[model samples]
Target chain A: MIELDVTKSHVLHQWKADSPLIACRFSPTGDHCVSTSQDNRLQRWNIADGQKVVLEGHESWVHALTFNKTGDQLISGGCEGRLIWWSILEAQPKAIRSVEAHAGWIRGVEISPDGGMLVSVGNDQVIRLWKTDTGEKLHEWPAHERHIYSAAFHPDGQHLLTGDLLGKICVWKLSDRTLVRTLDAATLYSPNKGQNAEFGGVRSLAISPNGNEVYAAGTHKGSNPFGAVHEPLLLRFNWADGALTKSHVCDGIPGGLLYRAAALNDATLTAVSGGSSGGILLFFNATQEKEFHRAGLPSLARDMDIHPAKGLVATAHFDQHLRISALFA
Target chain B: MSNRARYACGSMDHALSRRRFLGASGLLGASGILGGVASLPSKVAGAIPKNDYRVVVFNMHGGLSQLESWDPKPSTNTGGPFRAIATSVPGIHISELLPKTAKQMHHLCLLRGVNTAEDDHGKGAYMMLTGRRQTPAAEYPQVGSVAAKMLHDDQTGLPGHIIITPGGGGGRGNEAAYLGPKFNSIHLGGDKPPQNSNKPDAIAQEAEERRHLLRRKINEQYLSQRRSAITDAYTHSYEQALKLMERREVFDVSKEPQAAQDKYGNSELGRQCLVARRLLENGVSFVQITHSNYDTHNDNFNFHIEQVGEFDLAYATFIEDLAERGMLEKTLVVVLSEFGRTPNINLYYGRDHWSKAWSVAMAGAKIVPGAAFGQTNKEGTEVVDGQVDHGDIFHTILRGVGVDSSQSLIVDGRELPIADPAAEPIWKVLV
Candidate 1:
């Protein structure tokens, strides 16, 4: 039996700061994790020693951050609607490129598979694709009539998947920025109330290792007067046609709000989701065709990263702590 | 303005003439004029007066089982537990639960074999409401939206279209769809009378004075911004809202006579139907009343019994009240659902989703009375003859209301037909 030790085995790392941290990510090498705080600073922390290397430039809170595929560069988006890219080389510790990307708050950002293109979506309801090397605008498409919450690049770098505030997911062909297909997320819910809940937009997206399947997780509130009951939904869509093939409900997953998800391998995945009540890490193995297994970590788990060379799962929580665990079977 | 000055203006003369005509015609209580005009020969189109017809579609949100409602198949095993009874019209029959409706069958033309492509509730609701299958590029407008688009009168002091107790089932496609929100039906969220109709006496006088001043301000602003389409649409909606606010009496069901309430029953569905009748009487082009909770996956018999009881009393009273008020002939009343239940009862003692052979009923307007349009199989599993799909039903409704069904909407440089390009209206139902 796999036993959980919350009292004695809990690992908590606390960094005292003046403001709350909104987003965090691990370096591709997993040696360090970068956190963006409401204090308008991006702190790079040594995973072993817990020392911080703080990078300060943004005038406002940093809302999102990510690393490029090769793990040689870091990019952060903020309320300033500008994308700041940093070189990971030891000699250059500052941002290498800063591009004015959108007219509104940058809601999401993704790096292309080959690390050649960077895409950002925002409250402006527009998706801007850029050449990562020069920060030159490549193409732009008005993806939805409402705010876009999340976006991702296809594994082959030829297409893009995006979700809107209305709970609609669309597949776009990158060459001309044309909408190829749309997946109605409402179908995944119980058919009775599904139609009324279709407008609850997707908040997070993850692509499988082989790129054949893309998973979108969304949040919908019921229509009762007091307030809608928040439910987190996971949908798997065919990467090529954007056809929604299957759906699973992560009902009441520690945190009612799902903030981030990532594919751990071809068949295994992990998600970080929660709200005011706090969050937990959820693990699922698509290869086994079994129910999702909860990893039982206690905190407001916000984002997660998986080691490329090893099977280590690292999660960042709002409580200013990090938990690293390995899958056991 | 002085009364004499108002009279000196020709507008008062027109108002007086209209009022006199209305009084002489007994408050337009006779439906013969409207129905006669709809059924007039096409060559005499120019001779018919304007603003004569109205349509009210009461959509049962889910598929109400045929065996428990309009077309009971008591002789077959698939019929379940309901028994059939004869209607006032010779040789016509309806479920026993609808005793009141059976007595008013002379005004109903039940279409017994309607079919559609989708079985899922979301897609099926879209198909039934919009009369078109779901497509990627465009969404077709609902029948009410189309009717409002074609028949709305700028001078009319009421909403061109309205939907009562909406959001029961299906998506927001129940509105205008591709026609955009401007043409979408103004939804009344619950069974309660509209908000404007609920003003207290103390606020009513003050509100009226403020409304007059606001109207003048709005007209001035609109006059200056006449060149913008957004401004135009806003002005149109504002003017319609003003007109609707002035006609609060139309939404006040309490003001209706006790006999009228008794005839329409005391349920929310009855009140909604009564409200639809009142709006139609006030020259509203289209009104839709949705009755929910028809999704009977289990306890199908007991559920339908209660549902049909409500429908039978409310629907029958609505038809009778309209006829007694002489509004039935001019208003087209349609009863439809997303689809029908399966012919066979499942192990759960419920009929599953079936789109193969269902029934819809039409009455009033230009429909021929005491008629059934098609036949179902012996076991009632499939359509045996005169099969009709969503498009056919669409064309039939448009035809009943005297609109050309062959028209098409142009979207993205593509011409999409209003009805199915391959289907035709059921000629037997129309005169």
Candidate 2:
């Protein structure tokens, strides 16, 4: 395995899309990748030859996308609240199963580590669990007062954590479907009274590979919520006690939002931020309060993901492009 | 004809009793009472007109997205996340975010091809409100001020031009320009009454009366030496202030029935709507309620969901109430913004300002109900037919309320067209 090196990272390949890309992910085999965009169709790109295939199903922008552990099937959630299961490996990539999952925009969909269950959260403030293969709902409940933005399952599979616009993290004990505890990441939320608006939220969440800590990323210090004038922030919490461990901040990026983040390893975390000024990729030590490495992108990025095995980073950008960068020279 | 009493009585059951006017002496300044006695218009004795037309303008401050409220382009790349829903008018649909407003579409007329060609916030607002582009050569009056000057009966106690803003401090807005402070908007910022509305305890009613009498004599002496429109406007503003105090109860939304308040909701926009209803019901000729912060450069979709959600409830309720009260026939209601948000969703999922093609909606008075006067392409990027501009909208608004937009107001012996003379009303959408 190649160790990730933030200092030596550089763009390796870039492919243009039909519209601004919302999210992207590498396949488990690391041979191909898929991306969701502002349009209804999803694009699958083969890493080797730059081959692209269109996976069509969603009626609106597909915001949430995830591949099952085996990479045979992919589930996508859209603004129209429809969830679709697609046969990604097939040449045509047909949508195998579709369900009306939520009442509003679906913000996130994550497959549990065991690959049997999928967790979805949406603007309706509800959390739902689904059978990955069948597209059948198992259990669902109103988990937050505000819109839930992201969700993550603990490595042990006993617990699930969800984050919302108010910067609240709820830990649900999966056995009884009960909330065990909540982690406070309030800095990620902003209630702008003058504008009569509430901006910011825990936009992205990730758990360490070893399950020792969890990271939440979003925006804070929003002086003008309507203008989207704010700063990017990343937070870490100790998994055992659920105590806030560190708050990582990037200075001087006014329109910044830590839109997506992923734990690269047990000790390192990477985040991509999009803003009025531009987009930035930042790397931080899990326990440290400062980001040690940073790189500016050509334009604003909406999402980012790590390679399944190789030291490569994939980012979906507003420039209507999907970028792949090698983390080591 | 009972002088201006028909207009003054409005829809209120309560009469403007002479005793009540005399008893409300301390609430106004001694000078205001004196000015009312000196400069009261001679036309106060004229017969009240049968059609006491009025206007209510909803300035959706910042830029409201045309796609989100009035003309949604669903399934298109620029349509954002919202879907289009059917409205009461056949073949008419609006964004799903405004479901309540959609139900009232039969009473509204849509102008989907408004191209103001100005995108800056201040400049855009100027064109929409004054019906003319911003130029250093001349300053024009806002529609509210023009409406007040044209439709208002001088004997009415309430100020003709009134504006309500959230968290706005009560005062006068300097929007009248050459129309003078007399026709300027008396701003009721927040839900509170006009600033310094209540009388101080130190000033006794009887003493205030004596002071008013003495000041009136001095004012007569001073006016005899120097009499001009500027002086008249100064004296008239004082009289307007006195009248405003006499009818200060009209500014209080708390006086509205609990059921009415509940129907309008309890949000700031809700309270402002209630106040607007009260002002209109009490015979104010022109009322402008500003619902703001729509300048969503970032997080446009989420912010609009919240902002337009609030507007949907309050606006629809206000329209329904006006119709129920039979005031809709006499009130020209318009919903306008400085500009519309761009169809292009930016990196922050927000929209920038776009003026090439957007929409504005108006209803009541002479406006043809359930009419869509213009058309945009499938993607809503540009207007394909029946294009109009700020000047056309301004003329249409005046024509709706029976004010001749083509006529010119003689200001200081100079002819100034009420609206832009180069542009005419959208006759296709008017009765």
Candidate 3:
């Protein structure tokens, strides 16, 4: 794995799209990048030549995407509650098949370590598992009472963690599909009474490479959610006992939400946050309570993912651009 | 200004007659319409007619997003995540956030091209409610006040105008302008009756009666010596207050059947809507219900999910109830807001204020049911057809309630048009 030195990070390239981008991911092989836009189209970018190919199928915003272990197949879920599988690495990647996955917005989708199973969660408050290649339903269970926002698989491939709008993180043993434990990232949720609203849920989740820890990111202290008055919060949890280990926050960045997070290693993590002011990429040491390094973006970012081979980060932004940045000099 | 005759008429139906039927009533005088006590023989009070024309305004406080309510551009770059579901009107569709309201669309008209051109909360609210641009030089009367004056039933004892707010302190609002204090709106907090509306138990019935008799005697002596609009307004308020106290139960939603309260839901807006329906049924000429905090600068989709969800159940139930009671044809229902949220979703996952292109809804009275007038672009960024503004809406509202929008009121010897003269009613959507 490439060593990450966030302080040396710099923008590598900026690719423009027709509409604001919501989420992006780097292919496992690190040669291809994919992004979803507000225009309801997904685009795959060839890293070396920058050639773009549209992967069109979703009838609504595609908010979540992931790749198979072999990097030959891609899966995505959208606001319309449809899931699609794409033929990645092809000259003109196309949707292989599509299926009605959830009754509401599919907030998250993840490929299990072995690439045989896929886990998805959504506004329907149901966690569904499917066979990656066949697009067939494997198992389904009522996960939470509120909308589920994110999901992650333990590196060990035995447990799955799902977070919800109420800031609850449920751990399920993949074998029986039964909840093994419930963890709290309560700081990531808030009830904004002034607007008669409940907001600030667990927006993104990431498990450490060693499977010893997990991270959840969202907004906190949302006093006036309608006015965009809040701050970003990232919680670290001990995977073994489900204890809240650390709370990482950026005091200077108010009215912001940590929309996406990724564990670079067992001791370090990266998160992208955005608000009315703008967006920022933050680097945190798992043991610390504050970000160690922060970099500002040209506009608000909706999602981020790191390249597996080079540890380069790709950020999807509201300015209709996907920014690629290297985490080392 | 005071040289003008106090009894000058306004509407074309009473044009140039130079006599105000309301002023001629003299049951308690102008002030008695405010809330204070005044002496009048109980036999003089006329029963309100069931068929009296009325107007109901749903003031959506803070900007409501057209993209999430009346107009949904699902799957578009600016549409967010909601789908546009089919309404009861067959081809008509609205944001799924208002599914319940959609079921009642056959009885409503959607004004899809509204461009008031003002975005500030205070200014937008002023324009939407007053039908005129806000200027330091002049203040226009609000729509409720105008409706009250135009539809005032001299025979009826209830206040002509009433506003139900979520957490308002019940009282009178100075929205009447030159119409005189009598047309000002009386506020009610949620479904509760006006504050201090009941006679205190601390006072004996005999003593209270004796005190009222003495006060009337003194007022009679003073009126004999000096009689003017000011004194009449003050004294008249008392009689109106007495009437309100006598029928205070009309504002109490608790008296409604348990099923009704449940149908309206248990949200704050639900309760306000129930009270609004009660007042309208009791012959209040104009009623306004305010649902608040739609100013979503962050978490727009989530906030709308909660706010609009609350609105759908209550508002839909209210419209359905009015129709079932056969009162809809004589009552105008308007759902409006200061402005609409932007089509562009900001970084905070919210939409800011947008007034260039939006939508409003109207139903009942003389409106064309199951009709959708005007049009917005595919992305809802601009109005593409049948554009109208606040002035037009004001005129349409009056015309819907059988009031002549072209008429002018003789106030203080000056001719004040009931609505803006520069604009006319949205005739296409009117019956």
Candidate 4:
């Protein structure tokens, strides 16, 4: 099990990413990882060996990346809104199929638990589902009034959750593509009073291992036009009831947002957020809605992936630094 | 005093000699105010030959986000969601939010290293406008005022300096401060005969003419006896106003062909750009248009898409339209703002005020188009080279129009260079 020593959490290793990492995901086995970056490239790394192979194809920032059920292939999307499927089994991963998927930046992608469908969401305010193996577009829907930041498949494999710029989250049944429910994560939208201007969104979504709870993370602040606040936030919700169970706000560091959130085997959450300022990492016990550990990262981390077996975390920072931090020795 | 003064009005054109210009300046006749007038040269008026060099300034009222417009970091943490696209200029790329402007890159020379240290809207605007820090002792005149003072063609029968939709106060730069109101921009647009210029449509033109003749006769008689500077200024203003009334059609863009109007788009900025072109065509020396709400501390990306998108179409169309008319050589178009947003993308997904590294675009005045003169660090956190400030910008724009940027004007007994004494024009961008 990973140790919960926040103070002792030090960077394990670091490398220059050449471009900021846009999104990253750890393989199911937690030994390997895949990441996309602003440089319009995809990369996969063997966490233990620290060996990486660059996969270049996307013409812009690679905004979304995910692994398939059997871990044979990786799916990714980016600024070009193109969905690319990569054969990850190879020493040099290859893009097997490329499909022009969205009209705007693809913000999130998730594969179904059964490995049958892949759900991708983007700034085009769309939620689309495709046949994972065939790269066939099965269903595409305008899911939100604003940019949809993240999408995820429910552990049951029959449901999906989508979060948007306006803090609206939608639950839909994948079987019939019916709208199951609409929930307000309004706390994420930091708005300035009397001004139509707002800065944050529901940028991240993670489901607890038990699948009973969902956590959404983003920026939270009061009335200010400049978006000058450095407050990152996490909100826990009862997935079954669509009720917000707890609002876990970060007081860890000056990082402005919780851009990415992940669920751990220990039933806790690891969150990261950063931009021009440095990144802040926080560990929260979702059920308790409380933070047990926190650490200030060395660079402005844009994305992160966790290797559960190794108790390791890898981050992509704005400084082009790809960092690895170990939770336990 | 200087050969440049003769360029101010045709009174010094080769047809009229220096001695004749002086003789004309000393006397006031119907022809003097009508076709042959030039501002009287003082002992201090130095030899600065003026040609018909016109300039138009688009003051983006709010601090525009540099990343989304000019220096897009695209895909970086600070770049937000916008993409950067290639422009006509071989290697130049700007935010995809400005597609039309991207196509017109060859006409735009970007100053990507503007470091105006002030960030507050009001103070920053003052710095950009006056090219100097705002001092409590006396307000510095703005670029428009200086242009008006140096280049106003008295024979144009219009205000030399003009501002359209100038928002009040704060770097919504008001009229000439220390330079006196004559050199101030005549506020126009929105509703016509702007404020006092309205000679009540209630009166018949002939009747108004009779009343004007009577007033002029009385003013001439009083001035003949009194000989006060204020009276002379008022009489000259009265003459100019009458001349403007006769040439009222100059401000009317409705007469422009529909094809031309459609080319500029149907938006307010479109109409203003079209009107600005006509004004420049009619010999207005300087025109300023302010596009507001660039202050994107919130929803920086979306707002920039809307606002900058609007600007791209109108500005591109305007540049192309002007170039096609062969006006580019004689006119300079400047796109600028107080400062730029920070390289940091704050929690709200908006960029805060960053005076450290920003950008401005200039064309005409023989500026090398498609040229990006400075470099910003990859993350756009700072300028890596060729950093310049507002004073240099002021110097560059004036230099484009043949104005002697090094010449000092006696402002409140202080010799203020036409451009700030601290700045020198960036020669690399100049032709």
True-vs-predicted CA distance for residue B154, candidate 2, Å? 3.5
| Clashes by residue pair, model 1 | A167-A201, A255-A274
**Alpha carbon lDDT of residue B159, candidate 1?**
66
* Every candidate's chain B TM-score: 0.81, 0.88, 0.88, 0.85
Q: A163-265, model 2: which lDDT tens digit per residue? A: 9999999999988889999999999998776566778888999999899999999999987766677899999999999998899998777788998989888
Flag clash pairs in model 4: A199-B348, B2-B46, B2-B47, B3-B47, B4-B48, B4-B49
Residue-level lDDT tens digits of model 1 in B296-388: 554355456556777888888889888888887778888888788887764323576789888899998788987888888877888888888
As for DockQ, the candidate ahead, 1 or 3, is 3
Query: Model 3 segments beyond 4 Å from truth?
Result: A156-158, A172-181, B1-51, B154-157, B198-228
Model 2, residue A278: C-alpha shift (Å): 2.8
Candidate 3: residue A288 lDDT (0-100): 70
The lDDT per prediction is 0.67, 0.84, 0.83, 0.74
> Where does model 1 exceed 4 Å of error?
A1-329, B1-50, B166-174, B178-182, B196-227, B408-416
Docking outcome class, model 3: acceptable
Q: Model 3, B215-302: lDDT tens per residue?
A: 8899999999997666776677788987788899998889999999999998878888888888877888899987776788777887
- Per-residue lDDT, model 1, residue B415, is 53
TM-scores, all candidates, are: 0.49, 0.90, 0.88, 0.70
Pick by TM-score: 1 or 3, better one:
3
DockQ, per model, reads 0.01, 0.35, 0.35, 0.11
Residue range A108-188, candidate 4, lDDT tens digits: 988888888899998788888999999999999877988888887889877899998788889999878889998789888
